[model samples]
Target: MLWDHRRRPHAFAGIRLQEFDAKAGRLVGPQKTIYHGTDLALVEGPHLYKRGEWYYLLTAEGGTGYDHAVTLARSRDIWGPFETHPQKHILTSKDHPLAALQRAGHGDIVDTPDGKTYLVHLTGRPTTQHRRCVLGRETAIQEAYWGDDDWLYVKNGPVPSLRVEVPGTRDDTQYWAEQRYTFDAALHHDFQWLRTPDTDRIFNVAGGKLVLTGRESIGSWFEQALVARRQAHFSLDAETVIDFSPSDERQFAGLTAYYCRYNFFYLTVSGTETGKRELLLMRSEASHPHGNLEMPFDEPVQLPDQGKVKLALTIRGKELQFYYAMEGQELTQIGKVYDASIISDECGGHANHGSFTGAFIGMAASDCNGAEAKARFDCFVYRPVQHYTDRYEV
Candidate 1:
């Protein structure tokens, strides 16, 4: 808490107090150094709340990793010296690595009409043992109450509880309901494509089907025909029917379990150089340099002259498998079971907490031929399967 030039190690990593310019409709002016904590190291995300005579200053520190926590400070005056909480951190999962919800911090407090205090914070669910956050960070709430000493605290203290009761209604039926999209009139709300303002050049919805005009390769960071939704469950099923005719090996259109260019499993309806239609499986991992694709099947499955193929993927915890079916036949498992953990936060683009995004299930089309062939998808279904958080049988 000292203000000596020799005491601070880093530049521009502390919490500051700024003023809002009402006339300019923006925040302006010089910043004031109210709290520069060297003990907690990486301090950021400050929120101020006033209750009675105490001014509470909450900050998220410890680098948003396993050691992430919520540090609270308070003072009678708005600008003088603030004392840290008795326990320092008011909400955290740092010590409880095995907890169902992990990486708890960067939170805000709320009060309800029932006169109860609650804190909503960020959380994550990692796969067992490997500790990969497959779902990235999620939101969680905890019951809180004012302490006798005038400090705010989480209900049970630092470690966040698995479940907390809040003043709200939760409908399980509607929460876990299946969503089916036909793409009849226009693009559905759940679907999103790559970053590009010129969407009309990549995809369009016509004749009750979502059509993708093959553009850049699927590994493209910009302007790729990849439409997808967030993978939000630990166990789930995703199915889509696509009719794509790739003239050569340079073209591909089908389903993909994607994380980034370097981490994904794509099952596509591609063609050989001689123009023979077939099914191909491509795998890429973090270890692969330059984002190269690994063709798994020595002999790709030959497809019939008909065009429609149903592509699907099922994710159970850390395992992912792909399936395919013809027009009137049942779905059949096609490729080998993949380590779904690879398409997660830890294994996404870099190792050691570099990436912090979840996976996505989507349809993609790539054409290096410059022909802009069309790939039509009629329906997509997302069905979530509830399961125990722990690696155990229900």
Candidate 2:
């Protein structure tokens, strides 16, 4: 439910069901209000379930924080007089600090052909003591059963388990490998392009290369060119080979671990007014409002003559390192390790603006002179720590 303006007693003027209308190419036709929470302020993420002659309405409530929970309501008709469950909350992670997953809510019920039901929902894992969620929100599944009173109950009663049993008929042998995007096809759905409103087109892919047209610098609140993907793990290896000739001293293109519009780290290929091209590694923080601090490098190094350079960033624990490599050569460390927490939700301040969006690592290109320079990426490779355990068994 959303509102454009205030309407006296009620927060919103109209209450409508959320649905997609493919014919109109947009979310339209709420049809009618089937259900709402007793505390409407905290109600969202609703899912409909049908059993026997009853239509069950499941909703996530109490905000998307430690107080989050899954509650239910039911009615005989599809659209009226829905009654909240006596239990109020069917699942939650409140008070379960020791549990592997916390802040659990937004559940969806999936029924198998064998009559078994399961609840799949969003959950988070905070660090051991800091209570900072480095892995961000993740999906978890829990088995469900119907009681004699016709109420649905999770197998372990509420807090999700670290070890979940899988169905006997489910496959247990498949495994996943590292992700490598050659840009041989479409950009992976996980990748995102960052830009400001009314920005010009600056991204394209053709001839097996992902090209980005340079615009304003990364710090620009107006039009800028950047493409990135989420940083899903504390330990990960991300690399990309970029090809961009610096026609002017103000042009730069490289890799970055972006947290928000104000916080990030960059390892870019740039040139000086004197025409000396080099790779620069730097970290930007909101606390240091003046400008970014340049990372120390081991020795003097310059960009390759061909303008094709491989840029890599690795995150292990709280340390982040940058590297560079030429064709057919080993990757050489470009600078000393730097703190990786700046690009995190817990850093700078509370959730506001872009901080709540999570961290991302990808390519960035900028031409401060508005020269419309372009940068081409050969490929992007990402290798995250893979967990092999029954807890992630889906």
Candidate 3:
């Protein structure tokens, strides 16, 4: 089952799960949201199940504030305007003794082969200043059993530990990794990511490797001209070899970590006044208020006679390292190790609020005086540590 959060019309909403035919690999139908609109806040969790002739849909209600709860809806058919309990709020802050003080929401439900059900929901950790959060929400398990009316409920309310047997077999611990995609094939904007993308600054997908033309410098508030996916906790290394001829001293082309319009890190190569390639690092914060800092290369890196160079970025946790290679040899490190946490929400800052997708690695080129600079990315690669025991199993 898949659960999605809908946020439209100025209020928190509910979750929706689609039921599909496993064999045909197509969506047969979907289970609609049981509780919706401002009444439920944001219903983010939806786990579906079939018990005898009845179908149960479990979800979390209330906002991410202090009054979140787990609720249930039931229907005879997989798809329905489900019937919510008259009491409405099933699990809430009042339900748990260990809830501390903040809200609890965004849960996952899992069922074992032995017909046991458990709910895994996220809860906030309180701090002195306020309820500042990382992705540090903890998961709690609750014992669930079918009631007299054929609905499911936690046995003794929201306990810290449900004490239910783990549903699946044990496996060795594995680390999560980032998945990288190259726009080498037909270029289309239909690909799925963690969030919707800005369409104006990104283009070109015909041959291989996506070509992004930078519109403004990295410090611009609304027109950086870079498109990227969101970066989660997983570490990633993105490398792309770009070929571009600098028409003027102001032309630049390279790779960047684009969090949003105002928060981004870029390592680019531009033509110098003296006709040499200069590698530089530029960054911005808070809608580009501080302008940009340029760390210049000690010596200009010579590009291929065709004026092409390869740029790459390696991101591990909160650090982003940049490197440039010419003729297949690492020639320069563009800048000091960038502390990525500074621009992330975890660091108590906001720049790229609307760009919540995963970290993206693509090429960008920019020119002055309306002169178009074409960059060809020979290849792009992303390598991440292995994190899944059986990726296909899920």
Candidate 4:
């Protein structure tokens, strides 16, 4: 069942179960609507669990503010006419000693095979001067149980630390294998392109490339052509071969880390005066012009006869390295390392707080007049690194 909080009048605040046919492997029935309205403001992190005769729908709410909390609602049927806790804010900051000074919310509930329930949530770090809050939100785990009234409760307040046993690790070699995604028409619906996307730009699906006709160069204020997916601390590699002979010499196309219009890092191929290819990294701000970090390759790696060349970016922690591959081999290491810290609040940069959201990887092409450029993305793969395993129990 998928919940849509963007319902009209904000009345449909609960769950909506879409019936599906196992044989056909597709949705089958008219969707059944459950929870609704102010009761589920910005409600997310929904996990359904069945025990005995009861089916529970656990969710997080409170608008990503200091008052954010985790709550519960249950029903006997899967498509629930569910009932919430008599008292809201079941698993909240009030229960933690450190919560009063900071804030914690957006929690996910995980139950063990042994029947132990745990809550994992994001919290702001505490410091002497509260003015400086790093965007790096930390995740902590705690033990939880139901009260007499059927309300969920966590041990300790604000910052609970339940000494629960960590689960055994799985054989990750089989799990870490690369999975391939073939570009299909059905992907338009299955994949979430963005949380909040600019409606003005049109994504040319037929052209096999996302074309951005918008004037904003990803660093603009009103509308920037940016699309990303959830971040999970994984290593990703993608190549886009582009043909840019349509315009005179003022066209560009490549990969970027887009936070917003005023903040992002991009590596692109621009037309030089002599009609040669030049690789450059552009960073911009609302108050200043684009900052270009010229990354000159040994020679101008020309796009194939198709007028398209492949570009790739590899992310490893605070370092995002760029590369260009022609044929099947990497041509030159585009000597540009974008310090992820610059766009991260943790390293003292002016950017939004990175809460539950992860970084997104995608391609972009823009600023061409008659010279129609087409970008063909050969492949995109995300593989988890060993470092993440060292940091978290996952």
TM-score of each: 0.92, 0.79, 0.58, 0.56
Among all windows of ten consecutive residues in candidate 1, which has the lowest summed lDDT?
1-10
Ranking by TM-score: 1, 2, 3, 4
Model 2 lDDT vs. the true structure?
0.73
Per-residue lDDT of 1-394 in model 4, one digit per residue for the tens? 2444665644325556676799999999888666551344756667677866888777766544444567677889988788886656556653454442234666777778988777887654332223222234557677776667555677653345533446776466755555443354433432344323543352444444444442334444444344444334434454455444423246666777554444456767666656666665666422233333334344554444334556666665556677776655655667657554333322222322333233445555555443334444443444545444122223
Model 2, total clashes: 0
Put down candidate 3 lDDT per residue, 226-312, tens digits, no spaces.
544434333567777777666556778777765444555667777777656667566654334543454544655555546457788
Candidate RMSDs in order: 3.0, 4.8, 8.6, 9.1
Per-residue CA lDDT of model 2 for 1-394, tens digit only, reads 5342554444432234656878888987547766557553456777777789888888887666666678878888777578888777788887687777777888989888888888888776655355555555668888988888777888886888766775777553322347788887777897887655433477778789988889888877777788888877667799999988876569988999887656779888877676677886656775565435555556546775575788998887567888898877899877778877667655534532123355789998999888888899999988875433213322
Q: Which scores better on lDDT, 3 or 4?
A: 3
Better of 3 and 4 by TM-score: 3
Off by over 4 Å in 1: 1-8, 287-292, 350-354, 388-394
Best by TM-score: 1
lDDT of 1: 0.82
> Which ranges of candidate 4 are over 4 A from the true structure?
1-103, 106-142, 147-152, 155-175, 184-201, 207-216, 222-227, 234-238, 246-249, 285-307, 343-356, 368-373, 388-390
Tens digits of lDDT, candidate 1, 244-333: 888899998999988888788999988989888899988888766656678887678999857699999998888788999998889999
What's the residue-level lDDT of 160 in candidate 4? 50
**What lDDT score belongs to each candidate, Candidate 1 first?**
0.82, 0.73, 0.56, 0.52
In candidate 3, position 125 carries an lDDT of 41
